[model samples]
Target: MNLDWNFFEEHFPLAVSSLKNARSAGRLTHAFLLCSSNAEYRTAFPPLLASLAACEHPNEDFSPCGRCAVCREMAEGTFPDLITLAPSSLSRIIPIGESEDEVDSMRWFESLFYLSGMTESGWKIGIIHEADRMNEAAQNAFLKTLEEPPPKCMFILTTSHPAELLPTIRSRCQTIQLTDNRCKYSFPNSETLLPILHKLAFESKGSLLTAEDCATALIEFAETLGEEAEKTVAEKWAPRLAESENLESAGKALIEKRIKGEESCEYRRLRDLFLSMIHAYFAQLALLVSNTPAELLPNPELFEHSIRQNEAEEFGADRAFRCLAYAEDLLRAMRTNANDQLAIRAFCLKIAFK
Candidate 1:
């Protein structure tokens, strides 16, 4: 949708100027990376960028005026030229599967790449909301698109974690790193997660015996985190679901599919945020021990007073770095459908005793 260029000019002046300069110079690349850890900007900037591409009357700064019909369609999610591909509701993973026959048709982005757009503004924009969520099949398919993009077509990808994406995929796009404006554990359930992390962070790390207990607690924490988020999500969507449940079996099936999708995606997203927070806790220690600026800390105020200092003194910065590595591995495994408890246990053990 149309956005206030003023916002970008104020907050993201460099990013706006880069894109605008490229467009002005007739040098816009086939694919551009918009990396931001901020969740809201991840959701807001894609459509705004698409609107810029399709704006009939872009200002000198190259942002779309919100008044045009094209801009309105984008705001309404009815813009024919601006397409979006997000993760499937059921898996919270982009089902860019092998074929249309295998994929849930509603969430497909693979074949759509091969089709021509409505040619509105002579620029077709396809936005992938979470580039990291694309499965192997989806990534492979998209790599081909990048190799030989269609005429007047552009792909804008938004991602919080760039490491999860394939190196080849990353190589094809021009990366734009957005400032990390997103706060750590900024979601509704972060308060629930932070306390559990604090408990682990400050706990005496001596023997392997307590590692199992910590592991169990971590697993429970993840479960409770997901459940708390689901409760909120379910309540938010209950009215819409209530209406759909009374429909015929076929119609009811459709609504249920949508509901399940929301549940799975929301839970997974919340679960990942918790894992990221866990990593940030360890990373925070590593940063402080390395004498990095406190301003660079993702969650500067998260670690309890004297807790991280004690942990660093006891475990040493090298081990703390290993803990961050272990946490990253655990996050990777969990994303690949690894059992939650088993992965958390492995992570806890590796961090503490490995």
Candidate 2:
């Protein structure tokens, strides 16, 4: 979890190298916009960047010394200057106001920055996680501060989708792009897992983080339902009944308990897993139509037994493309607070019947 050195060695090795050049040339930008497909890694990147900016021995190649007071404080999440802004709930949009609660949090963050900026280290760090979630009002409010940043203040905006950000805000900062790598997952016996992993990677559209999450969830789901029929049943029915009012009332009466509940993060995780699975399933169909050899296909067993059953001419590459579009739409619907169970059920049935 030593993200500072780990991130430096991994995706941002070039950024680490640029650090020395920028410092030597006195050309470091006051603000940075770090863009990446992996939202989790983008969130982790800011703290590492902050540690690098605040390092006492930044001139030394081995700096960030990990054991230093500042680094230790950062690792403990008590670093005065390192502030993160994120959505307060699953709705995934930051609230903007001068209300008591909002004011309190903002004051605490501003105080930390003010104190850190006054330190001899001469750097204060602020990270806006999920910058895409900032509403227009919130973004506009932050724009004024970004335009005239406090002296020695470094603002790092981490977003999965930079296109959603205002052009003016993006134009003011330097940009760094980070892509997740499967090799960085550190799964034991990963070499043995590479074939399936590679398939999921392609299914996730090159998002290794999404593929890894799907792989892990699929492994767990497979263990839960040992039989193929049971697995398919759960995949199909879990969503339909869970979101229906009839089932909600029946469960409440039978179990003498409430049934409507917030969608669990585990459910969202599994939805992503199923989406990836559907992608791989159709991809295999495409390969089968082209007369791909069994050993060359990612899931030859599935391809030979199930996918090939469908006529290649009837179910062509367009089927796969349509499924991808459906998955994207489901993802957007989830973000907008649609009923997760209904959205997932509809998505699954679309692919299952296709």
Candidate 3:
């Protein structure tokens, strides 16, 4: 997803046309709710929205000129007036800060909304990525901001799970659902988990060794989640760290702390993504076993080379439903204080023996 017009034109033409019309008529809403299960689209839309609203030299159809200062600033993620927030802490919920000074909290975002640095377009944009991650208090606080929004500000809240948000919050914003044909539950590690699921469904013989082997695979992957996150953070921060070679001790410490925080947040996000993939596997298993068509499944790709409707009878739909429940339970448990390896081991054993 390049933050360019072609991305929208090719992938989301209707959304592009609608927003173009809104901007053309000066009817662009102060707040927009962009809902999509396509993670790529969800991740790409907000920055594009900001570019559309604040681009200094938009074309005839309100498409952003990708060469202007606003576009450059946005591309570099240094736009002063564009604030983006996502789930940050280890708990993976956006919090309402105790005070407005907390950098990553909703209160801090609210305070930024009212500050007086207007860009060339006089628009201040705040995007809440994965807005459903906002807990009750954060959502209520955001609802207050929505009710009394600042002048010349646009709020964009994006979520893959809209049901997790408050009703009032949803009502206050104009919603734009991005529709696409991409698999909703595809993740970075889907390939790794798909084979494990295939084994659980079609290869397992209910033996302790088979169950332990599945558990070992899951545990191995879980152990390295943090390493994967750190690798990503290192790649992103390499240039900055090199440029800061002469910085003072406190500045260096601050940067190091931020990098550490980023690593932790990235690990948690990846872990949740894997958990989500596990749930999707079992869910599609249940649906496929119950005679659902592959084309109609949430993850149709999982069935391309793996399970057939007729062969799925080896692991009946009833047991698939139970495994789906365990996957849900695993997700909930991981969200709490439950240890990741333990949870994975327990879940694998249950699925293998069920």
Candidate 4:
């Protein structure tokens, strides 16, 4: 609800401009599917857009006037016309309600939209955070409302996994790609990994020594990830622990267990970023082989050095494509709990022997 209008304008200027233009032209769609791989954007954008539509005093471009009473209410989630549905804590799924009275369910969410608008803006907005979390029944239940809502009604569905949603639901909404180049790849400690990729791509053509070194570096990177995760989580929990006076042993143990769980999750998230960067690296290589313009690459800055040095290696386009496939497989295997060190070694060997 606390949306940063300036930050959105700065980071996602195109998306913001498109939305504002649509609103100003009175051509805003009744339903929108805001898609993004970045979780932060997925969480932040829907409410901001809803606020823009419902703001009593919006700017010329339809950006919400944050000082207005309506904007403040929306920020505090007290706006009667705006409703948000998200996954439950335990199940991590949104469900079709047993009845219209069931709070925070698909049925309940739909029922609210039928009511008259509570504000003068005549905008009734519903936001579905992680819309992909809605189960089949929930999705089916909401389809009717998404297809035809009340007058001036708006529904926004935000998701990192759009493919999980039903095609019927997807077809009903206007798709908005909510990508921010600033942190899209967000590779952790990328400085240390890019050089290894440089060596693999141009310097060493499947050399055993380079592969061995890359494997060692990757394994060490994973270890460092764990250490960093632990330190970060511990520092976060330190102040709260210090503030607790005579905390019971059971409570302390529970806190410790929670800390450990968070540390594991953080480490895995960082590792996934590293994995994504590897995929991006190979993807860039394939693009390079295909004679793709440097500016058109996903991470243009990443390949600037190679472009500047005119280092187009004698690698075949097919080989570069194969490397992309290998990286995908490695990512899949890692997700399925494959041994990290072993995976790194095998991946390096595959690239080396290619």
Number of backbone-clashing residue pairs for each candidate, in the order shown: 2, 0, 0, 0
Per-model TM-score, in order, reads: 0.71, 0.62, 0.82, 0.58
How many clashing pairs does model 2 include? Answer: 0
lDDT digits (tens) for residues 80-102 of candidate 1: 56656667543557766545555
lDDT of each: 0.69, 0.56, 0.78, 0.75
lDDT tens digits, residues 1-354, model 2? 555566556657786677656755667687889987543456456666666667665546644666666776555444655566655455767656564246213333344554535355666777776677777877776777778878888888877679998888899888887765321322222223344533442345445455545545445443332243334434544554455546657653532211111112123223333444444555555565566665676555444433333455455566666766766766676566535555554554455444
> Worst lDDT window (10 residues) for model 2?
256-265
Best by lDDT: 3
Worst 10 residues of 4 by lDDT: 304-313
Which whole-number lDDT from 0 to 100 does residue 254 have in model 3?
63
Q: List the residue pairs that clash in candidate 4.
A: none
Point out where model 3 deviates above 4 Å. 1-4, 118-122, 184-190, 240-269, 292-300, 308-310, 335-338
> Number of the top candidate by TM-score?
3
Candidate 4 residues 1-354, lDDT tens each?
Answer: 233878888877888898899989878888999998665566567767787777788887788898787787666454657777766444557889899888668888898887777787777888887788798999998898876677888898987679999999999998988675545554347687788777766655658998888888878877788788788778877865675546888767755655665565456456656777778888888888788877777787677665442454467788888888888888766654447788878888888787
